[model samples]
Target: MKADVVFINGEVLTVDKHNSRQQAVAVKENVIAAVGTNDDIKSYIGEQTEVIDLEGKSLVPGFIDSHVHLTIYGTNLLGVSCIESHIHSLEDIFTDLRKKAEETPKGEWVRAWGFDQLEINEQRFPTREELDQISTEHPILVIRTCNHMCIANSKALEIANMDEHTPDPEGGIIERDDNGQLTGKLIENAHMQMFKVASYSSEELSISMKLASDAFIKEGITSIHDAGAYGKGSETLRIMQQAVRNKDIRVRVYAIMGSLTNSHDFVHQMVQAGTVTGLGDYYFKLGPVKLFTDGSSTGPTIATRQPYTSDPKNSGIIYYSQEDLDCYLGNAHKKGFQITAHAQGDRSIEMLLDCIEKALKEYPRNDHRHRIEHAGIASPDLQQRMKELEVIPIPNPVFMYVNGDVYKEYYGERINVMYPARDYQEQGIVAAFGSDAPVTFVNPLLGIHAAVNRKSKTGQEVGEQQKVDVLEALRCYTINGAFASFDEERKGSIEAGKLADLVVLSESLLTIDSARIKDLGVELTMVDGQVLFKNEQLMRPSGVRR
Candidate 1:
């Protein structure tokens, strides 16, 4: 009965199927030895074992991020800051750009991210004419926080040879001023044109992936679903594959393959090569083939059925036609590959649902569990169909706090149904939550707060009725996330024989003020019976198991 470690005298919120609670947990090697009272668990401890006394603190399953771009996060850390902390006005953006521009060698491409025009002083997008002033010599590209749109200077436009004569790609737009001149803003696939001008080096990609893994350990995120992995054709896959071989993957990852244009081709490649989900072990695994049907919710590219309230003439953009999606996703589904799509607007969601329905009827597979990422804005009919078709909705509640006002501006009264967590739960549909990091912070606690609060940056409630309790919100991040990734049996909950991956919090979220939940800190994080992070200030002194 001896164990490697024992966490004793703690309030353990075992997010088990039965919703059980325990006072102690014993770990033997990489699995949970037992979950029981402090006295009972002590029986499994040995003299050489490490014992931690929780002192009534909170211990729960480690957070599993359902979606994230770790490589992008690492690269963004190295990029220039353009968020609110660095810029509250267009002037601040220019100032930051000017600094970076001065340091860069003339003609090289200068890149940055996390800029939101809604938060800037000008309260509008900066024109290409304005960007020319920042750097007429170097190609400057500043991506918005949404990552669905970006602004490029004259040099960048010239470098890519984008002009009025250059027509917009099928799923994107090249914004122009009233005079029919390039405004330097590229929406959706139009931003892909920049790839021809600038591409990230393999070293840059590897460095960022490592940096991102380290950051996840500190954040108590034990697992992540890399939503897009094959951008450069097996390059992303090889990077993570090498990470696992070198033990650089600090956290478990389920990488979803990225496709440039045709998802059908990507799936055909996988099926032909005998590549299927769960191809790897616990540390690294191949996940679903991810495809995008639309763009970001906070941005103007979500592809709605109705025009935006703020910009009445624009109804947003849908990236794929119904016939096109069916051809791609239907083929993938027929080949036994699960699909997770990014669809933010109602029309796009409808498109995916229709395709999924047709695929199931034609292929006749059960437990397909195909997911809809961001599923940000759904119609009542869409929700009902999601339930009937067994489609999983993976939504990021943090967007409510980060861009709630912008969502409200575009949605108007339709904001009532935006991110409807309570509805999903009550309707017997399993919904998972994610941070969609690099778009927003990767803090799961903040995600929980956003779900329970449903409040905006200014503390305005976007949808009071949509709020879920703290535990349900927690389940969405942990168990439901595990379910989404098909790892519920080994991870997710604290139960006997389960993986010893857990997080210790400074306060009990159940008893704390809802507002303070977001402020709570992770004191310790354990993966496979090893402590990865321990905050000395919050952890108690070691104790003898006896």
Candidate 2:
């Protein structure tokens, strides 16, 4: 068959077994037909083929963000802006909120995310009274960057019936003052009380998913492993599944189901209902069951081996009991489902590794592909266990960029030990990189740049010794990400008979200076022979010549 589209005069990094870099590539019906020198690919091009001169640009496999919060990111993008900007004080936060209120209609709930108390001068959660002073009528809720915590204005607390007498629920905390009055801060499952009352409609969730899909495609992301999917409603999941079936989604999604109040019952029902891991086709698939083992480091809520240097009274909170976790894993493993546990601190990582090791020994299933999402602080011994068990560690490299300052404040000299990506590599563990969007930015280049530089988003170095090279960072986003999702054979590289998911870049990342890597731009993104996003715009059929 004649080639449908041929890209010539380009540097193509194939990312194959040999790491072969080529000059030209030809595509026929979405699969790569040829990858070789310009003269070699020219034979496949015919009069009907559309030729694109890359102008000495670069081409590689479409990026796969191994961890992301699609629904949450979309909701935040539409709701309010709090990321990628400095809010130094309460005055600055109120200024931004007041501006948003002006644009938003009165009485409508004002939902915002990505606030970090540690980043602000006060280093404290804003109170309900502070927000009520701005607007008593509107229900304003601002989520912390961790997503494990949030602060609700008085209106929101009233709507949720949370008052001085309201008791803290299991697995969550409602911060209270010395006088036993609610302080507007909610952590973990307690955040759900207000969130349930503030949840969006199915229509709104659908819009959010569409918006997130568009954003991912624009950044050359053809596939993403949604880190957590919760409270978006069953209808929202159905809408996403249907969109994938109809080929409406431009990128593939591997969605990890969120933990529930009765997680064991939930996983049981989901499995019995015929939902299995790797259930669907290319566009959508059932990933692992997500469990939050602990909280975020910035919040001083992560379960650590030692007490925080800043907060002597606190160690951290555990979301699940040891018995509950073991039971959940055992049942899920029996049902042929993989588990991806969110563990950040050293203690949390160690506990989860123990559970996984015990479960594998008891269950003994081959190809389980169990993973630890955000194994940020693994000790040397734990690293050896991770490699021995072949468990995957999906780290958020973007966190290093966005939260390094907070790390310094909380852990002091221990900041280097946190987010040990280089250690994972040295121990021969399969470590993948992702941008936990909404907590950080969604751009993979920024994540890769942060991984390679070990520099914070504020342009300061945190763990200079742990820095990786550009090619290694790229593998974390591409090949290692594919391994995390079990899609290595079909995607993650440019090869014959594989799906034609690719990204065309304005510059060659391999040849560029490390400092300038973040400036790289995506010129085009293609998924399964269709142009999804092109040059900061959505691509339509008319613009693409087949």
Candidate 3:
């Protein structure tokens, strides 16, 4: 039978067992029909087939970001950028905020995200007073890059009814000035209050998701395991389902319900309502329920055993105690739902291990594939426990590029095992790499670069011994990601009969300069035999030599 499409004259990295290399690949319908030499594949090409010559480029399985916030990633695109490159100082941030305030109608929220105090020239969080300078008439919110913290303008703080008199919520901090006045800065659970005044409609979420998905395809990502669904779970779930039905989904979406939204009570409610995993096909499907044990390490709020070097008194915070986590995780585990918790610090990681170990002892379910997202800062014993339980660690290596230096400033001597890549692999753990997008850049290549380089944005190495080579990093982004989703057989590798989700790159990572890995571009991205993105100029006609 003639194939639908054929690619020839390329270094086709079939990332299958034995790590085979091929010269050509053929796609038929929505699956890979053949993987062989150019002569063998060319024989299957017939009239009406779209023949693409890679012209000596590299072709591998499409990237699968094991964890991300798709709608959130998309929504942030609409807000003020406020990245290091965009705004370098508090003045620059205020200017952008004031600009957004003027553009938005009065009393409406003027929202901005992705601002890091460390990256800004001021090297401090924007004060409530500073935000007021932008606009007191507008309720303003500027989310930190870490997303665990945010600063609200006075109007926003008032809209949420937060004041100096209001006591701190459980495990969440509300920052105040020296005079004991609200600084309008909220950390951890306190940030949830901002959702009241600043909210996303289903319409907005759907639109932003499309935008984010489109961007994902351009960067060669064929699938994303959405960490937290849009807004809460109910309305957002309906919207996502509708997006899938209406053909609005750009790439494959495996949604993980929000931590609170997928709570014990909520999971039972959802189960009673006939909502569960395996409800949809490849384009969209329900996966696990997400839980957050602690905050981000970059926020310095992640629970850790050792006090931070910068703050000797602080050992970070844990949102849940041992009993609390067991109750939350046990509920979902009993419901036969996989759970992925955000465990960044060693303390939080250990606590989750304790909970998981207890849960498994009670239920004894094997091959559950429960995951620990951002499984950062593991000690030797903790790493051993992670392997013993077969819990997959979805670590975002790209953090090395952005937060490597910050990690050192906090953990100091203990930085060696932070976000361990080689250790996980060496100790027999199914470790996958994900972007956790909008938290970091969404490109897998950059993640690959960071994994291979272990270098910070400023060229400082935090944990050089933990670095992995390009192949290992690629596997973490590809097959290991699929394994995390239990969809390894269907995709993830360039194997015959597998779904034709492949990406064509400008060069092979193995042969390139490791430092320039992030600079490599995706020439084409294919999903289910359909080319979702293509740099047309890069594709040559059949029979064309490299």
Candidate 4:
């Protein structure tokens, strides 16, 4: 009955059912008690109630990244160069690698990520010989931005005991030279073998998870859906559970367990253990069963309908066969588990759509809300079917900015068709926006800009025709993201009875120029009637409730 906090004198983009705008919002405990004019909100402002003046800052729901690699992003936060280094030539990469190798202990593994050969205008992956020249004693591994591939130094390969005779694992590739020598490039599932050999300890995982949680809080992200947690067993899930239990995880997590060989059995056990989706409090929840249909376009490994323009000989590989995908989806659907398939290329998306269609026909369920993560290149037919089937498309707009050049080089004039955002919207499909963090920075503003602009980070227009408006982009990050996760009724908007998970921004996104949208900063972030973050200079009211 009493108000815990009242935010006044602000332009509130409520994103409510009526898409209403309000001047004030009153919060009681954690849920929003009232949303109206300042006069209407005054009744709830008791003497004990904390009142904060926004000074006309724009308030919206707290940004939710539907897809992110939380633990991996946290681990990369402590890694060496390559991401920040502008590798003009292979020598520049080598120089940085040598420096990192020198700093690392002699026998300790040297790890790095976010390297692109295209950035350096290289035609091939860096060989083990080049890395061996730097340090034969230290095991070195660098993961590509796509995460589908990695370049391991000879020492790392030796440590894994991977040789030319090592057969490529199912659903993966171990690139070998024409002379039948290992070229240090591991793709898809094969990368897992080496990674398992060089896996981090539980202590290291805990540190990384904590670091990532801290970063998420700083970024004003109250919740995130970790795309997939990889490894044998539910180690990542257990680590997250422990963090939440210890009160170390400041941000809530929805962890999607990666598909396993024994997924049916594992999922059955998880269900029996009461690990169903949406089973936990705000701290954590068991999410969808993640299945990868193909690799990434950054490596030109997304199984496209046509051969890649850059590599005519390759049309990308399908990680899961149709039969395997159907089996996984059918079983998961029957178990009432939502499925989030990583489908990028047209062929991959087509296959996933087919599998979903078959699943729907065989075992129909209402409001399935199964998602196609990174539905990058959906055809018109697929888009229409996605609407009819109620499939969610969680697209990464930041990918347009981060990998626009790669798409340009790989698809040439067909790049517009690659990420058809406008087409999806026109077809009435629910296209949610996400950053796919660690693949890109976790900035919702940047993603909004990219979605509305379709421009590369270098300020070049990649797909101007595919751009949406600012409001539509905002909806994607807010309401649409919530819809994808089936939390729209409880969160996402600044409506009465909804949880007060809101963000106050320094600049009004609606009034800002589209070109400068990415420059907007969060002035405050509040979750559950609590001020989680406020600008350093801003003073909070005394005697605020914990």
Candidate 5:
């Protein structure tokens, strides 16, 4: 049979069961027609086939980002960046937002994200009063890098009807001053409420979704688990379907369905509608029922069994009680919905495990593949429990690169066990890697680099004992991610029958220095036998497009 496209003279890292490497690949229609040496695939190429000579570049299965807030990441692209690398102080944040405010229409919102108070010189969040100075004419909302908290200027708070007398919402904190006035810091559910007031329009969301899809393809990510829809799952699901039909979203998505607020009702509605995980098509599918059990590790708000070393009196935030988790998760489990939650600390991990364990006892289902998003600080005991239940842990090792110093300060020795890629490997657990985009960046190379080195950006070996090799790291981003989404048989590897979702890298990951892995560029990204992104600068002269 004639192939639709042929890639030859490439180092093809299949990341399959045997960790095999091939020299060429041929795509027929939307699936891999063959994977072997150049001679093996040359026979499949026809005159009409798009034969691209790789010139010794590296080809691997396209990255599968197991967790990402796609819409949020897209919108973040539109907002002012307050990341430490971009802005080093609160004054810098004001400068950037002020510029954005001037460009925006009065009475509209001026938004920014990716600010970490710990990284800034002030070592504190930009106050609402300070943000108000940028533009009282426009509402200002600046989300912390963790996404669990944000600071809203007076105008935005006014729009949300939040006053000095506004009590904190359940499972959230509206910080107050010594005199009991609004400090303008909204944590957890309070942040969600602010989001409701500044929510994006459908048109805006469509634009952002397209932007996010483009960014994913540029970074060689062909499949992603859209961590949240940003509102009600049912409505968001329909919007996603429409986006797919409209050709706005190019990458494959496993749309995770749940809400941070009104979660019970969301879960009930999904169950009642007979929606379960693995629903929908190859391009888009319904993923797990997700819930947030705790806050972000970088925020130092993850519910740990012990108090953070930096704050003796605080053990971080747990969003729900064990009973509540059991109730919410048990009901979904009984309904055959694959369940997952944001459990980042040992305490939160333990709490979630209890609920999963209870659910299985009541309604045992083999190969459930229930997942723990972040599973950021699983201890030995927690790891044992995860293995026993056969639950997958989707850990964002990239957190180690972006927020490792904070983790070191807050959790102390816990850094060594945090993410724990090596431990997961030894225990035979299929742990998937995620970027948690907009929290960190969306590049899978960053995650792979962090996993291999276990080093923070500042040269600190945050978790030396937890380091995994390059091939192992690649597996987590590729095959292991596919396993988490139940799409392993169809995509994830460069096997003959698998979908032709592949990425050509400027450098071979297996041969690159661990520290330099994050620097490698994507030469091309393809999905369903179609090229979505190509770096013209890196293209070989002999690589001709049909």
Candidate 6:
């Protein structure tokens, strides 16, 4: 059969069930037509076929980011970056915020994202008083890297009606000074409420989604399990579908239903509407019922069984009681909705497992792929439970690279079990790697690097025994991710019948210096047999040869 496109003379990592490798692959329509040696695929290359030579670069399955916030990622891309690489001190942040405030009209909102208090020179969140230095007329909100917390100026707080007298809401915290005045720090639900007010309009959201989709293609991410949208989960799904309809967003999205709050009762609404997971087409599908068991891993609010090393009084925060969790998950489980929760800490993971185990006892579903978003600290017992329960751990190993030092101090020896990828592989558990973008950046290569190297950005080793080989890491990003979404058979590999989603890389990750794997670049990204992103400068020595 004549093919649409044929790629030859390169290292092709099919990332199939057996971890197969090929020399060439041919695409027909939206699926892979053939995968074999260059000579074997030559028969499919007709006169009209576009044949491109890879020279010596590498090709692999397109990345499947299992957990990411698309809306937040888009907003971050458009906002001023305050990440450690960009700003070193609070003064730098203030200067940027001031500039934004000056440009924005009075009484308008000013925003900045990705500030890690640990990375800043001051080593603490910028107080509300300091943000007031930017503009009292305009509300300012600076988000922490964790995305679970934020520091808002007095204006924004006043708009939220938060004061010392405003008691901390359930599953959230409103920090106050020793003198009982608002400190401007909002955690969990408090942060979510403020974000709701400061959120973008539908028009702005469409633009942001487009920008984020463009960036994802550049990074070779063809499919995304969008963790959740910003506002009401249902509304977020609608906006995402509209973006896909408008062709503003290109990546296949499996959208988790529900926001961080319980006020919406999205699960109840979906069940009432007779909806279940996997409810849409390939471009946009409704994923599992979403819930949060705990807060951010790096923020030290992951609800561990033991107290944090740095704070002996605090063992972290779990959002729901056992009865509440059981009610939420059990209802969804019986209703045929695959359930997933943001359970990062050991205690939180245990809580979720308890709920799942109880639900299974009452109504057993053989293939329920209930998932834990971070599974940040998976103890041996917890891993065994997860294995027996067939629970999926969507762990982000890249967290170690970005926040390993803090983890070391917070968890001490328990750090060895944090993101235990090797243990997951050995135990035959399907653990997918996610960036948890907007919490961190959305580069799968960095995740792979952290998984293989088990080292931090500062070269500090973490859980060395948990390191997996490059091939294992790739599967975690590709096939494992597909398995989590129950789409394993159709995509995630370069098999003949699979979706024609592939990425051409600047270097062979299999043979590259493991230390340098994160530096490997994407030369091209293809989705549904169409080249969506191509780096002209990196497209060296390639031509359509008849």
C-alpha-based local distance difference test score of model 4: 0.79
For model 6, how does the per-residue alpha-carbon lDDT over 1-546 read when each residue is reduced to its tens digit?
Answer: 999999998899888878988899999999999999999999999989988888767899999999998988997876778974668999998988888887888987788899888888899888999998778999899988888899999999988888889988778899998999998999987887786677777777888899999999999999999987556667777888999988899999988876865633776777678989888887888888878888887887889998998899998887889998898878889999898888899999999999999999999998889898899999999999999999999999999999998889988989899999999999999999999997897999999999999999999999999999999999999999999999999999889999999999988888899999899999999998999998887787544465
Give TM per candidate: 0.95, 0.93, 0.96, 0.92, 0.97, 0.98
Spell out the clash pairs found in candidate 1.
Answer: 230-258
Error of 3 at 463 (Å): 0.9
Q: Is candidate 2 or candidate 5 better by lDDT?
A: 5
What lDDT score belongs to each candidate, Candidate 1 first?
Answer: 0.83, 0.79, 0.83, 0.79, 0.88, 0.88
Model 5, span 197-290: residue lDDT tens: 6877777788888999999999999999988845655666687778887889999999887775556667778878887888888899998887
Worst 10 residues of 2 by lDDT: 537-546
Residue-wise C-alpha lDDT for candidate 1, range 52-113, written one tens digit per residue: 88878788998999988777777787678787575788888788888888998899767778
Q: Per-residue lDDT for 229-323 in model 2, tens only?
A: 44633444677777667655568998776542333445556666767788887789888877778887777688888878788777788877777
Compared with the true structure, model 6 gives a TM-score of 0.98
Candidate that beats the other on lDDT, 4 or 6, i.e. the better one: 6
lDDT of 4 by residue, 1-546 (tens): 669888888889988767788899999988899999999999998878888787677889877888888877777766655667476766777787788888888988887777777666675668878888989989988877776788998989988889998888776888898999888999877876676677667777788888887777666677788875445437767887898788677676777766323333445455456555677776677778777788887877888888888988888878778998888777777777887788998899999989888888988989888889888877777788888888998888888888887789887776786567787778777777777878778888888888888989887888788899887777788888778777888788899988788888877778888899888887778877778777765434531332
**Candidates 1 and 2, the one with greater lDDT:** 1
* Candidate 6 residue pairs in backbone clash: none
| Ten contiguous residues minimizing lDDT sum, candidate 5 | 229-238
